[model samples]
Target: MELTTPTGASILVNLADDFIHGFAKMKVKRIGYGAGQSDMDFPNVLKLYLGEASGRRFNHDEITLLETNIDTATGETMGYLFEQLFEEGALDVVLVPCIMKKNRPGHILKVMCNQADVEQLTALIMEETGTLGVRVMPHAHRLTLSRRIVEKKVVVGDREFKVRFKVAFDSAGVIAFERAEFEDLRRISKKTGLSLRKVREELKS
Candidate 1:
């Protein structure tokens, strides 16, 4: 039987650091099971184990970092450039105000993307900003934690709104931190006439 799908295999290949021959020492913290729709003679469930490992706990991945200095682009042009970069699948983008050569005020545009996207994104940057050169650093190491998004309906005063929370988990399957989606919070605040800070506080309580 074909037990593993292509998507599942791809995820394991990219995310797994190493494959063990047998079980290693582990402090079991949490377990999850997924079942198929049809009932079989034997158990048809996939088991997932989350626990503490003796060595490294955090996940790591490689990414390409692209940076360019823009001294002539206007604020509006930079803003549109950022919007387009994100829409084109940039992992993250940052614009930092800085003093360039000759002490001229400018902004540093930094972009992070998958290694395969370096060529396309670099071209996009040059096309948008008219910059002659971009600094491309490949294979940049990044440490990361397991993360997931959960959605729930939250009631604030007389109104109920749906909100999604971005949750990050540590090595032991414990929640490291979580936060409500900013857009949902902003929507709730606008509808309820509550300040953004107050909306967050209310949601916490």
Candidate 2:
């Protein structure tokens, strides 16, 4: 853009990079932008008009992503892998099922962690499980979190199982999650005389 004064002299500057610099040199009363020609090389570039109003400051930015997939695996092993991730450095770990390549059944393992540790965690998973090379990528983690576990005793014949009900809570403190894994609750119930409902109810009493 070229700015001309009544003196018949003008200044020419590239509006993109020189906008802030030029504005800082002269007194800026306002700043704005108009539709700029799209560049094939840079999808995000845009031109700016600066007359400027505010004082100066700069800022930094960042992004985080967690990704993993498991197809040739089992529920028990997957549970263990999740636990291992938490132990290693993961903030959160979860499993999602999806139909993968060639229409094979699979689980998408999403793990939240710093970018630096993703590789180690992926390597651990590959070493522990017979899975092929892990597929990792950047992803977002929008989590409202809490922790709770309810122990229930389920009876199957003479055996007792100590099953656990895990529920995650949201900011409102309501249970946002509930997972009842026959996770041994049946074993404890059968060994003891207490019923499943009794054990669950005992949590309150």
Which candidate's TM-score is highest? 1
Note the residue pairs that clash in candidate 1.
Answer: none
lDDT of 1 by residue, 24-98 (tens): 678889999998776778898999999876644677789889999998788989999999999888999999999
Per-model CA lDDT versus the true structure: 0.88, 0.63
lDDT of 2 by residue, 1-205 (tens): 3233344232344323433433354355555554435445444333444553343222222324555567778888888888898999987787889889988888888776777787788787887667676666655534445658877674444454556787767545666667665545454455566796765564444
Q: How good is model 1 by TM-score?
A: 0.69
Q: Write down the TM-score of every candidate.
A: 0.69, 0.40
Locate the minimum summed-lDDT window of 10 residues in model 1: 51-60
Give the poorly placed runs of model 2, Cα more than 4 Å off.
Answer: 1-63, 139-205
Candidate 1 Cα lDDT to native: 0.88
Off by over 4 Å in 1: 1-56
Best by lDDT: 1
